[model samples]
Target: MTQSTPSAQRRSNLKHRAILDAAAQAVAQQGYAAVTIEGVAALAGVGKQTIYRWWSSKAALLVEVYSDLVSRQALTPRSNGSLEQRLTGLLSALFRLYRSSSAGAILTGLIGEASRDEQVRAVLAEGLVVGRADIVTALVQAADASLNAQAVNEVVIAVVWQRLVLQPDSLDEAFAQHLAALALAAGRLS
Candidate 1:
């Protein structure tokens, strides 16, 4: 098969970015349940078939959108403080993202969709769960090699997931501090 030229590739990349942006905007404005391929396509100025060609389902599209949102936010761990302070800062940043933006709603919808769709479940697990755990694990291990990084990562992610799913409104600074302390405590025990 022949490869596309540079200009053609640029056009494709632009369209892809547009589609992701449109999907995110649609979800932010209409919510995940109200979004559709047709709506995203219309918002992106592309045909519905274009969206289908890139993504298999609404869940898949939303996952990409969510991923894009997270990456764009650049939520990596900071290195300017003590371990507990850094962890608390990172957790607080995550909580603020969830409470202040459409990311939270998009993630909640993806979780619900994952329950019923195997493909969605697999994608979510690979795209989100593993990546999040790895980030937390790396942060914990970097700060204190003696800490049980895996357990700490699991607890941090579990608390975040629980709050995101059950008590999103409670994702505040206080909760972030609590979670960070809990992670440190768990790490100390190990």
Candidate 2:
């Protein structure tokens, strides 16, 4: 069962979401090379110390922005259906969320920065684990029909993530629906 977020935690999450929005916009407009914690603070209308107090580095802020943006969008379903249909809708929703320029730009900047900063990469991976796990859990629920399924299911999702994030390809709704079908089938969740 999902636990409810405490009020204090919810309030803190709201503040951080605002910061992420501001930071994402700053990075999207100025480029990662130009982004600074001070600039993010200024754009966010918060003190520089506030940003520094919460995050260790610009890369860390970016990672949090990406993670927060992904996490805010709940992945649960409103109706029951075949796994293929459910996963198709979920992937399509993910595509729609990531298609936002602000969020996409933040993720792109982090990925680019990670190539040059091993420390940033490790930190980002650690920070993103929970959000990634949440996403994986949604996929797991949809692919739970078959025995010996999880390994194949993860591979399918790995491919979908690569196609959507790494490759120079669009993640249109049609593509998401198609990938979801393949992934669910590959997981033997027909």
Model 2, range 74-159, lDDT digits (tens) per residue? 65543567666776787777677777655566666666677788987787667764446555455556547453345445655566
The deviation in Å at residue 16 for candidate 2 is: 4.0
- Per-residue error (Å), model 2, residue 48: 2.2
lDDT score of residue 48 within candidate 2 = 82
**lDDT comparing candidate 2 with the true structure:** 0.69
Weakest lDDT window of 10 consecutive positions for candidate 1: 126-135
The number of the candidate with the highest lDDT is 1
> Which portions of model 2 show Cα errors greater than 4 Å?
1-18, 142-153, 165-169
Which residue pairs collide, candidate 1? Answer: none
